[model samples]
Target: MALSKFLGLFLIHIALLSSSCFAADPFVFYDFEVSYITASPLGVPQQVIAINNKFPGPTINSTTNNNVVINVRNKLDESLLLHWSGIQQRRSSWQDGLPGTNCPIPPKWNWTYQFQVKDQIGSFFYFPSLHFQRAAGGFGGFIINNRDIIPIPFGSPDGDITILIGDWYTRNHTALRKALDAGKDLGMPDGVLINGKGPYQYNDTLVPDGIDYETIDVHPGKTYRLRVHNVGISTSLNFRIQSHNLLLAETEGSYTVQQNYTSLDIHVGQSYSFLLTTDQNASSDYYIVASARFVNESQWKRVTGVAILRYSNSKGKAAGPLPDPPQDEYDKTFSMNQARSIRWNVSASGARPNPQGSFRYGSINVTEIFVLKNKPPVTIDGKRRTTLSGISFVNPATPIRLADQFKVKGVYKLDFPSRPLTGPPKMETSVINGTFRGFMEVILQNNDTKVQTYHLSGYAFFVVGMDYGEWSENSRGTYNKWDGIARSTTQVYPGAWTAILISLDNVGVWNLRTENLDSWYLGQETYIRVVNPEVTNKTELPMPDNVLYCGALSKRQKYAKKSRFYVNGYLRKMAVKTNNG
Candidate 1:
């Protein structure tokens, strides 16, 4: 009987080994220590948040389906959370760093964020999600490479570079938070930064107070891929190199229909990649300009920031004056046209041997439609507040997910309207209840004078149609049902609307908010709660370990069911065979 059982177990272990999930995916690890360092990213020295003592934190690079584990140690005086911008936290919204989705990481405590970068590629970022900490630095780039079996859409470039551009304000995060709390506008930033450095104008001109200018050194006749991210708190900036045409390759995570432009407008929470060849004059450097758009120039202190592109054969200073933008500073039409130009490359493979999972989004049946509008800033309780429709979002006491899971009462209200309201402003939760596998068509209409950008947490929505004026049913006729680009973040023009199609396949409570941190803190955000029919751990992972209790969970004696991070039965046979071989 023992000999027979041993032979049977050996055969079973061999079969299980072939079928196990651990065969394909590899693990990546990171230890991030969040603390404050005194340094000058702009001209003046002040306290800025740093990760591993670096101004901009280290980069996290992985291929598709790779498991990334990051241990975040918070050393700030207050609670903080780090959000992965544009990452599809598939089946794992709990790892998403939105304030209400997951409890904040308290000071001196650490937590691990373990999630697979499933079915994603291209450029993205991570930043502090709460308390306006993004204003004081602490952001980094995240790049998901394609698997070795998957083919890249374009030819291989000689090198790759990441350029993080943003508008910089001298005020610390605490002051920014306090000002927003007092209902005041942040006005404008003092200058712009490229790769955490000040404007080129500040590199000198002051004795013992000069700042370093970011310069990209390269050899002539080589092609490079430049991944650009607008990591600003609030601002739409135009990026361009003085003497080169930017060949737009990809944006967000999807491959784009390659197009060439003199400049492109990148809004807050948006990212794009371009391919450029060092084909300019080798003996001189060229200016790289990033300037603010759609802001009052006279009132804004600084409008443009500069960087230099130096060639290996350059001899002296940059050749000529800074290049002019493709359009006037306030031309709305130009910005709209640029946004429309980005389309998905339907033939290019991403993540697998298929074109974005071969998702024919247009052919799917639409199960729901929602019209959400952004109202102009209004005074609420004597404080300037931003609202969606007639409601200003107020965070619930406990996370909506936990409240729903543990049967906690009154922790959140779920009657959020699906359309714009014509009533008085109400301060309450921003919970939009959704069904599992619900196919949705959402119209984000911005009636406010200023341009606005919106972002969803879990899935990349296809931008099908957009236009000026109210979005009528007839607007659906103008939709690009064929090759609309898919992205997690999108922009809505002033007095215009952007139409998107999203499939609610991922289940959990996700955050939908504006990328502008000021407006986000002041109540212009929402929680999208997607409920599956079955509440078992199969639909979504169970409560992760080491979750610090907050709100009602703190008063409870027992924690919720914990995650079973292992496979049973068959795995034991595999282990026994390996141990006795």
Candidate 2:
């Protein structure tokens, strides 16, 4: 009887332990209704796509390892898909929100993205991934805090701040899309915006009675963590606060080596976190400036945005005059130096250096290399398209993941070339097949005179090297093999190249594309299919039941009525050949 009582006591202890663990990791939920909203960001009334009728959507805040459930309902006429920028969906690639991997949530349909933040804690974001809607603003901040047990590498700030820097256009989304489709560039933005509001300027002159600028209130002598994201469709922005040195803390999911800087160059689709200690004189306010860089550097006079950093104890709203901006936006020497200085904090207690995690990238054995080059503008199928390795990518009739999951054929081919294309551009669907868990080295060569930024979905790559000239086998010696920073997006200088090493640990069809929205729409993108040798519960789970299949896959049932033949669970209709019928 005494032994039986001891066993009961042991079971009770186990149950209490399990209950405490469950309480530590809680679920966070959000319902996002994407619809049209009328708001004036630049003092001009314009209709924009927003979530829950808010201009900048809603900010998502949660802790690491929490299951985040976001129910997105598309109420607009067009379809919608939200890309969780820098959130390495891990093995759950279906929630990556790439059009090639997951089908778009059609208009009037609601889809819930269920996934875990999982070992990641840093500054990230979410934005609409379809129909150029990101420019229209269905974007928001996605902040993940460290769990209770995990100690942050840096000191806790007194307060937290989030700023989104981007270029704003006066024209509507429809007008912008039509212009791009007509083989014309976006030219230039009306002005830059900080958190969706700034002085409306044209031709270097502010509009009469422009809207009030966005203000960030802070207490004196307190340090604040400022998380910034460059969510612009195009253009690189250099962000700075007058007379304050920024202590770099983090970038995306990796904790960076803390360094002090006056200005930070944030490329498109990139996010950064910096610590701003307000130890400056509290007598006057300061100016937070975000100026356009790399694009139209000659027209710097009209490419700047400003905001106010107000101290709580300041007397008046006088934010003084703007300080001198970065001397030269096109200074490649200065930009390259800043980029090289960003290194990974190897001693940080995170997945980056943990031997048990998937991000032990320092010891990875690279198995394959892909050399991609950006070619000159070329015409494909009577439309101007940006060439990537001679193949201007085109979206297939059906989503590639669905096609692959059902074993359907003809959606895409696996003959994408790894070497740079030699002569002319061609109309082709570039689909590169990859082996699961294989380490990959991607070299991006930019022969054009324009600077380019590239973003990869589902994984963050280590920025190993950025060379001035072309990339070759000899350039491998210049790689920063030890302390290179891991990021989801990187910039390639004009007439130069950038190399990154990534491990294909996530199984899904992922997209590697230019951050320039116009270039992406013009086919400067490709897909990598990471196929698992065996579909198992551990490697890749089965497709969720709620996945919405669209495009050609939806029409296959109608075609099956005419000609009945099953092709990999999908009905295939044969075409009847005739002489003159």
Candidate 1 residue pairs in backbone clash:
none
lDDT of each: 0.80, 0.79
Instruction: Estimate, for each residue in 226-260, the C-alpha lDDT of model 1 and write its tens digit.
Output: 99999988888889998899999988889999998
Q: Please write out the lDDT profile of model 2 over residues 220-313, one tens digit for every residue.
A: 9999999999988888888999899999999988899999999998988899999999998777777888888776555655667778888998
Model 1: ten consecutive residues of lowest lDDT: 560-569
Residue 491 accuracy (lDDT) in model 1: 90
Which candidate number would show the highest lDDT if scored against the true structure?
Answer: 1
